[model samples]
Target: MKILTNLFSVIASILLSASIAAAALDPVSINLRSDEKNPASPVMGDHLQFWSTITNTGTSPIEGLVAWISLVEIDPGNEQPVDLEDWSAHKAVTGASLKPGETLRTDWPMRLIKGGDYRVVVSVTDRGGRQVYTGPTIQFHVRQKPVLQAGRVLPVAAGIPLLFIGLIIFNNTRRRHGNGRL
Candidate 1:
């Protein structure tokens, strides 16, 4: 009986240790940003850039990790997510591994075909199917190019000559007063 008790105790301890080790390997963290470095309010037919960072906060290194960015139209009525495979100019970076406490960044560039509200999402997954991370969704708006109208263009066109004339008159007055020449 004494030997059996000791054997059971050893097995239980080993199982507990293995469970702790498994629990330590948690999912990584993901952060997504939309043109945060140099923000631009894009319009239709404009190219938009996205960035994402995957950080390994767990105790173990992750291998065969894949990261991707997705875009969806949210406003002006919801639409299905855009298929990146269909986009000829879309590009994304993928990584193979991320060590503990290490960070990897990926960039995605896409062109705006329609102008409306949209959202960008970033996600990362590991090969072992043990970890998955998803970053927060970023919302943005793409506006259509403003229509050119005579009412808006004529004032600016008229103002340019007026400004030039004012500058010339001011210069002439200054010259005449300071040097006694007109």
Candidate 2:
């Protein structure tokens, strides 16, 4: 019984070490960034683009990797994950192979539909979905677009002033001609 227990312990330790070594040998590295490092108050209806760079740092060629971008709204009292189906058309990119030291860059174009504080991240996953690599988070805020009602009130506001000015001028002319009532 003692020998059997020791054997089991040895096997478990070996398996654990191998899994750790396999993780350490993963070759993929990813980085994500946007044109604006930290967008200074992007507004609703704004367009923002992000780039994800995937590199193989190990001595082996990596294959069957998929990368995608994620956006999340982090506004106070209104935090939620964003649905990118309509916001971005180029959400994911797949690489067939990445040779050692080779890099693949993917672009993500997004349109802001809602105003809120947000964060963006890029994630890379293997074909089998066993490994997931995430890049740094980019934070930003989108302000609500300003609404102007000048189109509805401009004519009235301008017309009233112009009419008053015309009346004043007509009254002055009448007074000069011996009719002083305004």
Candidate 3:
């Protein structure tokens, strides 16, 4: 009975120490935002810029941190596991140590390849692989460009030549009827 009690006490102490260590490492906060005003719907073939901000909120400085941005496609109807390797772009490594209360901002620029539903995920991890902070997922849709129809194109193309012809006729008539100076 005494041995059992000692074993339970040791387990509790280890769990408590782990919780304290995790609390001490909770010093970094990450936020992600896009430069596009309407990130929910971006036009296909347009360049999109995403910004990630890493702030050290604790008193101790953090070292050897790395940041990355990933793009994942979502199926609106079914449950599918997001494959991180699907389409990922942009990775930045903080070469210098981050001071307490300091912020580091990184930009990831990617061109829209096709029209579909997608999400961007941004994350920051410490060098020791003990701490990881991930920002909220940004859900967005890429829309195809509007098609130009003949109903819209024909009128503009025909109107310009008719205006030029009318202008030429008016100019010739004015020259013939009025004096050269007038």
lDDT of 3: 0.77
Q: How many backbone clashes does candidate 1 have?
A: 0
Q: What TM-score goes with each of the models?
A: 0.59, 0.65, 0.57
Q: Write the per-residue lDDT of candidate 1 for residues 34-93, one digit (tens) a residue.
A: 775534787876777777888888788888888877778777557778766643254444
Cα distance off (Å), candidate 3, residue 64: 0.7
Indicate the residue-level lDDT of 34 in model 3.
Answer: 80
Clashes of 3: 0
Q: Over 4 Å off in model 2, which ranges? A: 1-26, 36-39, 147-150, 153-182
Itemize residue pairs with steric clashes in candidate 1.
none
For model 3, how does the per-residue alpha-carbon lDDT over 15-130 read when each residue is reduced to its tens digit? 99998787556788778888865455678767788888888888877888788776776856743444433233554556557889999988877777766788887878777658
Estimate, for each residue in 1-182, the C-alpha lDDT of model 2 and write its tens digit.
Answer: 99999999999999999987976676777788887653566888878988888888779767788888999989888888899988888888875678899999888898888888889999887675587888889888889986668887899999999999999999988788875443
* Predicted model with the maximum TM-score: 2
Instruction: Say which prediction, candidate 1 or candidate 2, comes out ahead on lDDT.
Output: 2
The candidate maximizing lDDT is 2
